[model samples]
Target: ISQGIIFVSLLIFLLVGSLNGRQRTFVSDTVENKTVVEKSVTDYLASKFNTMVIPSLYCIVLLIGLPANALALLILITKTKITPSTIFLINLTLADLFFILLLPLKISYHFLGSNWLFGEALCRIYIASFYGSITCSVFLLMSISIDKYFAIVYPMFSRSFRNRSKATFGAIVIWILALFSIFPFLLSQQTLYISDVNITSCHDILPREEQNSYYFHYFLFLVILGFIVPFLVIIFCYISIIWTLSMNARSQFRAKMLSTLVTITFLLCFMPSNVVLVIHYSEFHASNHSDLYVSYMVCLVLSAFNTCIDPFVYYYISDEFRDKVR
Candidate 1:
């Protein structure tokens, strides 16, 4: 396993090195030709990141995520009894499955040098489904954490509040909210023909004026609704749960691991992109320059990893799942 990790790492480094050089040459050649700079050189960083990193990361996510999420769903249904937690877990697993299923199209898009051959309509649906699944997963994780928090922190009083019907209702609300979050993106155009690059770039390239006028505000709204709100709720719930667990009894390893893993993965996957997005849109919107947009795109690669790591999160949270896996 370690050998495989090392091998993938080395392969990525090689791809990054070769692709970056080629990108630099592409820029120089374009400049020499005196063709209008269709896209800036910094934009190439995102392109390079997409070409080298997205395919590899997404491939790994696809390979592991498909079977992991599928098995998680199967186990939750067959091996575990129905309950609030089970309902939430099942929904969460389904959310991850939705996210994972969309990755192959993304992998192909990036591997083809960011040319989105899927046409405009498919691109819209693709982006919508991508963000929708992720947003739903985030809210569902918060729901699960809250369920755990109440069950652990106030077991007696929490009984009425936590039930299968309530869980199902929460899942429905989460899915609706997720769809709402990405609705603006779905309605907007996502494909652009770059005459210089001679490719139809997906959401990566958009008209500067439209981005500044519309997308900047829309994406910032997304950051608040999708990332900020859910994260704060989940973090607070986890902290309270941790303290309660530590204070009332001996620290449970699995419980604590679940908390730590969720927190770390949430921050690792979403924080960078969210932060960079806010900064880039706020500061660079009018300038029409690539202010950390490459970094933003690169950070997005980490977000897809959340789906890959989510099934393992089920392992830590569910005793039935743990035993079944073991």
Candidate 2:
């Protein structure tokens, strides 16, 4: 698995390097009208960050996350019995797998200095998949926390709730919701020509006019459903679990430690990006491209790192899962 990961990572790096030189002329021609003086400092910094930093980070994620998630899936499938938590995990792994597969296109786009060589349809698909996976992963993590809450706090009631059919149904529902939530992206024209930069960007760097219309609505929807709702649910569940466990002397230590890990994982990997996204969108609506936008993009990249951290975290939390992998 490690070897496969390294090989794919190197191959992607080579592929990105080769494509980087080919798309320069197209990009140069695209931004001919707008001079450097007209571009905001945020835009300049954003362009540089997207080109230099984001692609390299994405490649690193692909290297570590791809195999890690794949191994997690394999272990879940071959070694463990089907349970509610594992079911949720399987779905999460699949979501991450699908999302990472699309990263090469993103990496290529960033590497080529935000020049989108692929047509508009692929751009829409990429946006949809990226956001969909994020939504799915967050929701599933929330589901797992809820599952654990029931298992620990109300063990008797948990038996019925923890059945395979229910877990499968929950997974299906989360996926459908995730996919449906990103439909607005599919409906929009994601690829836009930046006259200033003389390049067509896939998603992130959009024309100003386009940012106000539908993009605002899409991101608002994401903040509410994708981040806020899930954040509240996960927090409430963990808090309740911690409270319940605190009263019980037997499991308190394990519960507190587990809750800490989950909370840390969510706060570290997910919270920063979502918080910045909200702030970034607020500034965006005001037509002010603050440096916060750069911070938002950086946080977004950090969010992707969660895919790699998730499996290890899960392994630590579940003794069955750990034994199965061993």
Candidate 3:
């Protein structure tokens, strides 16, 4: 699975590197026409990337992520006793499954050269589900880390708070929060008819002037809450877990290995994309496309690769999951 991820990353880099040469040349020729040039470059690159790379990658993710998560969900649902951690994993699996199931629409849109054959309402639902599931998944991961921290560090104290009912309630709250956060996006006009291209776009184009301000603020809100806070929480929880385990010589090696794996997995799946999103938006507001935009878009899709990684994490790390599978 890790190798598959590395292969995808390398493929993206190679494809982007090839395109960058042409993009730089275009930018150089139109440097005198700054505003027009920036808009043109942004549109050109976005269209190309969205049409060519994104659709194919989404298909790949759909193929691998769908069945893996479905099987994991099946095992957890039918074979496992409900526990807090298992509940969290089940919710995480559900989020990934739901998100990827919606990818076929995205796949169709991109495959049609970034055209939206789907109606506006369906487009809004697509946009909402895509981001909402991602937010829910991240929060669920944070919930898992906190659960682990308590289980390892303060097992007795954790007993009262960590149970299937609380886990279910927490998952419900996360889903509600995720949906509410993206409600504005659903209300906005997500699909745009581009007369020039003779196609309707589903949510990749920049917002109109009237909507731009709201989008800017909303983008910042998502970055801080959806990515940054959860990242910090995961780090804190895992670091505490490692520190507590270090005192027990018998478990020291296990602690170090788990810490390393968790940190690497978390960073590999999310950090690059989230960091690049912040930079991309900063550049967007300045009406400049960062040189990193291509990489940013690539990383954004790469984050969805988490769907492939999460099931493996459950099988290997969660004994309940493993037993259920067995």
Candidate 4:
């Protein structure tokens, strides 16, 4: 988990640093005759249309995922013997459910051609909802890995110390951390003004000069807290688990299987965002020619895809889920 956090933190720093880098103008001779503001609007409309495609697909999955996850949560709660891992999964699913609920607002924002009809307060809530979902997902995954680490490597100690109450407390702590981490979106400047066309946008609309600073700081923080830290912990736990299982040939196969699943889960959920973030940063800082905003839109789509893929990963990788299905 800590390794994941570190990875995310580095990407965020790269993005934020790029944002604070020297400003590059997007306008060229061809763009000059047209209203820059209107062009921005038009670009946004096109981007919005593109953004709608993935989220719409995701909404369908969420439709299935939310209820399934809810049922799973209920089952876990009713179990006579509940594990710490179940506690983490419950919170993870809860966050995902909330995430699913917010998808409509996001989808609608794009469907309406990038015009944020939801106003400032809702805009803030929208951003927070998205950020909170993402942060909670990362932290909860980390917590699960930690629980697995203890269960496998220190079974008796875990039985004594990692009981239901501690598990619930851990989940609470992760949620609180996520809530605090994403609160900044609530305080951020969400509206962008176009002086040339008398219009406003709900996207992070810092001025050109300030945009870089915002990105630099935001990216740096995310890299540290979001990716780097979580990834490290996840990797460390898995390593210990693998080592412990390997000492006994009977469990070696299971350890390998679990390691493979964990790797696939992390790669599917986090790797795309990491790559997209890097590309987006490059595009942001590129001087004369690149379409940075387009790059950002692409990254945004990838991030959303990450959100959608999570439920499937959860279903497939969870042994508890499989047991229940049987």
Candidate 5:
């Protein structure tokens, strides 16, 4: 049954990835005086489709993730052995819970047709927590992969790395790094200003050129540092672990299963958004009205829901908590 669920989840991820890849976007023409451009109705439909999913996912996060993560936290904190591995799970649950707690602010914003009913202060804090939790989650997952690598592949060296003190320190470092990383969003983003349209949006409200420049630089950094570097580390660690396990008398099945789950989780939860980001930033400077707007919405929804799926990842891979769930 667990294997079936894992397979279905992978299939869902692949479907989402394929759909994202098929999305058509509009890049601006360099020609002079091209104010109006053609936009496919299909792109518009895709945007609406993406936006629709956000609320459904919001329901899951609120109705399902919140309680599940909260319960998991109780279990991990009160019952489970406080190994470095479990410490990371605890941090993961905390991040998920923190992010889930902030979902109403976003759901309300989106349900109101992208209007920011919450004032500027919350806009900043909520957005910070949003980005901060996500960054923390990714790096923590990377840390988990690192922990498992040592534990499964190098048992002798694993002990030195698995202490409670070091994991706590690592958690603090991840939080601090995430906090600083999102600091720029608070200062730079502002409510959209348009005299004609009395609605405020909570993102880059700058001129097209300026916003694109800022997004391009930062998105590039995230792709490299946030996704790519962590990805390479995870792949290397898991590959080595798998190689070592195959040579050992142990089943090696669980190690392979965990690595597969991790890799698929990253691909589904992180890779699509990262790819969309690269495409979005590259063409953001050159986007026309129709296609550009739709693509933006799709990217936004995908990025926001990235954290929403972490619960499933936790449930599937963590042996310590799996039995507790049953």
Candidate 6:
């Protein structure tokens, strides 16, 4: 009976050992499978483009945009009276400042081969601000377009309601709306470590499975309300302005020129990225893979130039702005 008890104990020990060994082996296998399944940034089509083209552009934007936007903000505030026009210009400059201030991290991310050393929280903040600023610009530009439409098309009638107080309120609502639009990104993880490259990418990679549930809808809505709607409104406002102006105003040329510039800025800076991102997230949601992300990244780089271009828009949109410069 004593010998029987010893045998049973030995059998139980062996079974436990075997189970632990199997568990370890399973865990290792799952990790190995994950490594093999996930493609690193090095293998990505945009990887080379990111390391090469993006950093340089970001550097240029940083060098040029930081001071330009700061100066524009100062001028918009101290140089002009706080009219609706000036309020919009101030907010636009603020948006550009918020975006370009984050560019240093972006530049470092690219320069270091897309490795994100800043950790997860910074990554989330970076992406949130990145997109928040973009949406802000789109919305503010639309507000400005509407302001221009009221000022130019119905100047006499608009004077009753378009005051400093209303403009300030509008600006606040737009700011809240723009950042609120990015609330989803703020809630999710934005940084991932790629085993193949031994690098952590900040918002450079999206989880293949996460898009279908929420992101697909978020990006689509963002593009529509944040960009497409604003774009159409801007176009309508500009068309109305051009149509309403009398030829003798010589200011007719200024209106036409400003309209052209605003259209070009929207087309070049905001439209492509918005379009590409919609396609990217949609395709990624459906197929678990996307090919247009490289285009989206490139277009985002173009969007960053909106930082440099916004000051010019201020000059054209506000006569007070032009007067301040002169």
- lDDT by residue for model 1 (1-326), tens: 22243345346434533321111011122234343333564266346666877688889989989998999999999988989999999999998898888888999888888788879999999988988888888888888888998999899999988888898898899888888888887888877666656777667766555655677688778888878887778777777777777754446555566677887777778776666655555445233345355566667778888888888888888888899988
Q: Return the candidate ranking by TM-score, descending.
A: 6, 1, 2, 3, 5, 4
Model 4: per-residue Cα lDDT over 1-326, one tens digit each = 43454466557655654553222223222244432443553464446344576456656655765676666666656742466777787788788778877878776665655557767888888888787787888888888889889999999987888888999998999888888877677887676545453444565344444445556566557656886678778878877887888778868766666656665566555654554444444456445322444544555555455545554555544677656656
Model 2 agreement with the true structure over 55-89: per-residue lDDT tens digits = 89999999999999999998898888888888998
Clash totals for all models, in order?
0, 3, 0, 36, 1, 0
Global Cα lDDT for candidate 1: 0.74
Regarding lDDT, does 4 or 5 come out ahead?
5
Tens-place lDDT per residue, model 6, 221-324, is: 98789877887798889878877885647867777787888887877787666656555543442322324555566778899999999998888888788899
Better by TM-score, candidate 6 or 3: 6
| TM-scores, all models, native as reference | 0.84, 0.83, 0.83, 0.78, 0.80, 0.85
TM-score winner, 5 or 6: 6
Q: What is the RMSD of candidate 5?
A: 5.7
Better of 4 and 5 by TM-score: 5
RMSD of each: 8.0, 10.2, 6.7, 5.5, 5.7, 18.7
3 or 5: which has the higher TM-score?
A: 3
- Which portions of model 5 miss their true places by more than 4 Å? 1-53, 248-250, 289-296, 299-309
Q: Top model by lDDT, which number?
A: 6
lDDT of each: 0.74, 0.73, 0.73, 0.64, 0.66, 0.75
Clashing pairs in 1: none
Identify the runs in model 6 with alpha carbons over 4 angstroms from their true place: 1-40, 45-48, 247-249, 285-291
Q: After superposition, how far is residue 274 of candidate 6 from its true place, in Å?
A: 1.4
Report how far residue 280 has shifted in candidate 2, in Å. 2.9
Tell me how candidate 3 scores on lDDT: 0.73
